[model samples]
Target: MSAPASAAAQDGVDRLTYAPMVMADLDAVFAIEQAVYPHPWTRGNFVDSLASGYSAWTLHDGDALAGYFLLMLAVDEAHLLNVAVAGARQGQGIGRYLLDKVAACARGLGAESVLLEVRPSNLRALDVYRRYGFAEIGRRKNYYPAHNGQREEAIVMRFVL
Candidate 1:
């Protein structure tokens, strides 16, 4: 079982460990990316984010990858660029755990708000963000590519810490 947020990954057995993402981890990360999203981020995207020094972090369940999140902290705001829990691990609270970690990291970086863009059609993710205290702040027209070569709108949400 996962422990309290205050507990480090090394304390006893929590089965969750996180560290700064390295280039080597991208292959697995990209695989998860492909499996989870129809409009998955390309290898170049992850590579460029790493090159630009974004806080790309990942979680592990023992030797297996559990999840990953990418965030950009700037000027009192943290942009949640991307976050994903491995498909088989979805209902296990790993997403919430990672989110809490992100919030904490943002707070440490002196951010007052956390911002993320979500596709309106992604009800599962919308539910998660809403339950986690994010509220809709705005919308982006045709922000995401959709089925049938169409586009989907994005809901912009913010969580004030």
Candidate 2:
């Protein structure tokens, strides 16, 4: 596949592009997953998502893997299964860019809203989602793995399209 468009770092500009995730991109994607999360999804999880035809996209800054996200479209809602930015690229507006793309993709799929679950401890992500117009809709008990073999609650959020 052709490389993504080159990134332009001048004047704090961002030139990011994304492509559909493929099996060949898993090594790099998994590396980022391992680096970014304490309870990262396994390679098998990603493989399964692809096999299930989940919508997965990998963001690139030129040739560098900057980030990626996955979505599963339901009848009228798009569930955001995963979204991540490389540690080095966090806080560079990449997350927002990815979110924008996610909304576009969801709309294209005839979704009326986007739904996701976020760890309560992920304050940074929560802030981003709130600022992007997502509202807390509910909570899920023991939704995520936590430290010391405990479980963490998930704050379910939704953004109406």
Candidate 3:
């Protein structure tokens, strides 16, 4: 069966706002990560991202967390490190919204391109990246640690801003 209609509606098609993530958002953001990712990032990771000055954002709809993304900026590029829409809010264009916001931020920062890595097995995410004009440039072997102590390869994708 497909996801509930309400859940689909929560995918951010309506009145949603995007803003830079702050320290106060860590709790809700980490909760979403724990709910959605198999190998979720720790609180430390999020803290470090903020501390190290990564560009991060959260999508909200009347106080509900719809999604978030974390990107690192370099001289002429932005690297997307983590991105996710709430599990129940998938397939409703939330990812696209987040991507657009990231691209805009990159442009504002004078970036020429955006880069990201995704697990080869995550076809859904890969498709989303492709829809945003991200092209595979290379692969990193054993990049993602798996549950059974195994590792999975990650496909590196890039989009020219």
Candidate 4:
């Protein structure tokens, strides 16, 4: 385990604990995903990731689920498959904390860069990625399912290690 990371929430400062996510955490993690995203990744997606041995982790603030992230490494690059902070825990620097952890994990795996895709309308996420040194690399058309049978494009971003 690493030193606890702190995030200032509305209640006070929360000391975050990082841990490898397991099957047992799925209930809480899935709840967060359903709550935070209209087009959330299915629970099966998470299960598959774990089954495939991707890097999956959860963040907790004193037994309270705070956030989670999934990373997939391919050759010299790492891809951030999914990352989310609890709705109540957003804007408290937890996203960056998760990113920092994921980046470290990638680097440890010998990845030279990290890549991700974000919906263009996800302004908050876009800002976070940019602030964390990710740059727009390209766009993927119709990459994300949208409301009413539509599809949304994805803004691809890359962060070099």
Candidate 5:
């Protein structure tokens, strides 16, 4: 599917486009994921997510892959499973763009809220979520596998649509 290009970037000059994720985009997606995370999701994980009917979309800046996000609609809520902006594109508000896009998708799907779990250690993401109006609802203990072979707690956050 095709999503119309978004209005100019925050700078008011660049244009962005959105498209449904395809297998062909996996290589780039994996590369960005691998670069951004200490423990990245394998290609198989992405494949399975697609096969399970999750909604995934990629954002592009001209011909370059800028970022991507995944949304899973369940009952009346939508879950934000993954959102990653290319290393080079991080800190440019692309992540925030993806968050807004997915939340709009959730609303279109008849969802009342958008829920996501972020590692407590992911300070960057925590800050973004907070700025995006996601409130911490609860925590999942030992929910994330840490690099030290130990588990880290996950902070469950939600944005009521």
Candidate 6:
């Protein structure tokens, strides 16, 4: 069964519920990824991340997948691998909710910070990260593949947990 439409369209102040991702969520998650990103992650990548023990969670509103996030915990930090909200759900607080959840989880795991890479061109995402107290620390050259065989730089940002 899919998520209820009413849940997906909850009012701005409603709290979101997050749950562990199951294999059945891949199809919906992949659809959102493709809709929201230029260069989307492949199914194998998601599978590998899951298989490798990455912490993966999906935001749900009564069985509907609103969004998902993946993070990897290291000795003293947590690396945010991927985060996306369904196309129709952007600009809602879902992204912030996901980030907040990750931050709490990182703190619980004794991580000092949370780190993530964002495409330099993604101003919206950058703003979201900044609002959450993430500051740019460095850049990785040619980190993300671009459309015409060129490459885009990735801004590395970190937030204290």
Please provide, for model 5 over 47-96, each residue's C-alpha lDDT reduced to its tens digit, 9 standing for 90 to 100. 99988989999987777789998899999999999999888877777888
Deviation (Å) of 117 in candidate 4: 0.3
The candidate maximizing TM-score is: 4
Q: What is the lDDT of residue 72 in candidate 6?
A: 93
TM-score of each: 0.91, 0.91, 0.91, 0.92, 0.91, 0.90
* Number of colliding residue pairs in each model: 0, 0, 0, 0, 0, 2
**What does candidate 2's lDDT look like per residue over 44-141, in tens digits?**
99999999999999987788899999999989999999999899988767778889989999999999999999999999999989999999999999
Name the best candidate (by lDDT). 4
For candidate 2, list the clashing residue pairs, or say none.
Answer: none
- What ranking of all candidate models by lDDT puts the best one first? 4, 3, 2, 1, 5, 6
Candidate 1 off by > 4 Å = 1-13
* lDDT by residue for model 4 (10-129), tens: 233346889999999999999999998879999999999999999999998887899999999999999999999999989778888889998999999899999999999999999999
Comparison by lDDT, 2 against 6, better one: 2
lDDT of 4: 0.92
State which candidate, 3 or 6, has the greater TM-score.
Answer: 3
User: Residue 54's C-alpha lDDT in candidate 3?
Assistant: 92
**Of the candidates numbered 5 and 6, which has the greater TM-score value?**
5
- The digit string of per-residue lDDT tens for model 3 on 12-70 reads 46688888999999999999999988899999999999999998999987788889999
Give the least accurate 10-residue stretch of model 4, judged by summed lDDT.
4-13
Q: In order, what lDDT does every prediction score?
A: 0.89, 0.90, 0.90, 0.92, 0.87, 0.87
Pairs of colliding residues, candidate 5: none
